[model samples]
Target: MSTDTSARWRLRAHAALGALVAALPAWASAAPRFADYPVPAIYQGRAAQPLLADAHSRNYATRLRDAATEKPDFAGRYVLATWGCGASCTMSAAIDAKTGTVTWLPFTVCCWDADVEDHLEYKLNSRLLIVHGARNEQGGGTHYYQFNGKRFAEIRTPPRHAPHPPGDHQ
Candidate 1:
């Protein structure tokens, strides 16, 4: 190609690249960030420990501890502990910060799904824990649970709509 044609092509490529870079931040901002959730001071300096001394996770050796963002009125901070159960499964537990007791959450979530974005989320201002995904071909749905100071109890409410996973029928 001639020098002028090559220059024009380079200019067009540069313009396209600039447009892509400008749009990237907008796309990234729409996703959730770790800082968006509240973390208690206790979880900040402590290292992750075994979820339970006797309990076994599928393959992982330790459970990473995080502060439960909701229900601040409850005494000490309740910890949200999570670990990989297997290649596709993730297990979560609730650890009582004061008592050092761990309560295993009921469901095992899919770490990777081709059809939908499967994950767990805690509501900001309540004791509600939502598990979002398709479980054993039941179709995608959000399962709700309320932490009643002792254990997480599944609530019989309708599923709320979330952006990432489509076709939630429950």
Candidate 2:
């Protein structure tokens, strides 16, 4: 294709994608708020040692173990352990404070849009996980996820119902 023809085609594709995103359901396109997915209650028991036998966990055993020492930083009873993979790239695993299970994030977050302040945005008492970057360096966009006890699932839509924080209005 001619340079001009290719440029026009790319522009049209971008526009089409934007229009589709705009037409999506609010929950699908909108970022989930931290207050919308609060845990019923925070875990109060002692943090357990990370189970290093988990798939891919042994490679980062030391890091995960060190992170296990800290209180839960994600969901209700999980500590988010993160490490830099390269420039503007990071890998993370969620260490269960109650069961010591390790669940890695679905992909390496990298090459975020310039507007994103944090690559990973999460709340200590909520299951919503916001990724403000490309997943595995495929594309640049904001992705919403929910911790499903085993792994983080990309959210195409928010839960039909979820508990709010203790004092927040319904």
Q: If scored against the real structure, what TM-score would every candidate get? A: 0.47, 0.73
lDDT by residue (1-170, candidate 2, tens digit) is: 99999999999999999998878765343555777888887898999999988558988889999999999988899999999999989999999999999999979999976766677888888998877667898766666788978988887433424322221212
- Which residue pairs collide in model 2, if any? none
What is the per-residue lDDT of model 1 for residues 82-139, given as tens digits with 9 covering 90 to 100?
6665776677767655544556676677633465443766533346565665443355
Per-model CA lDDT versus the true structure: 0.53, 0.81
Candidate 1's displacement at residue 78, Å, is 1.3
Residue 125 of model 2 has an lDDT of 82
lDDT of 2 at 147: 90
For model 2, state the Cα shift of residue 35 in Å.
2.3
Evaluated at residue 100, the lDDT of candidate 2 is 94
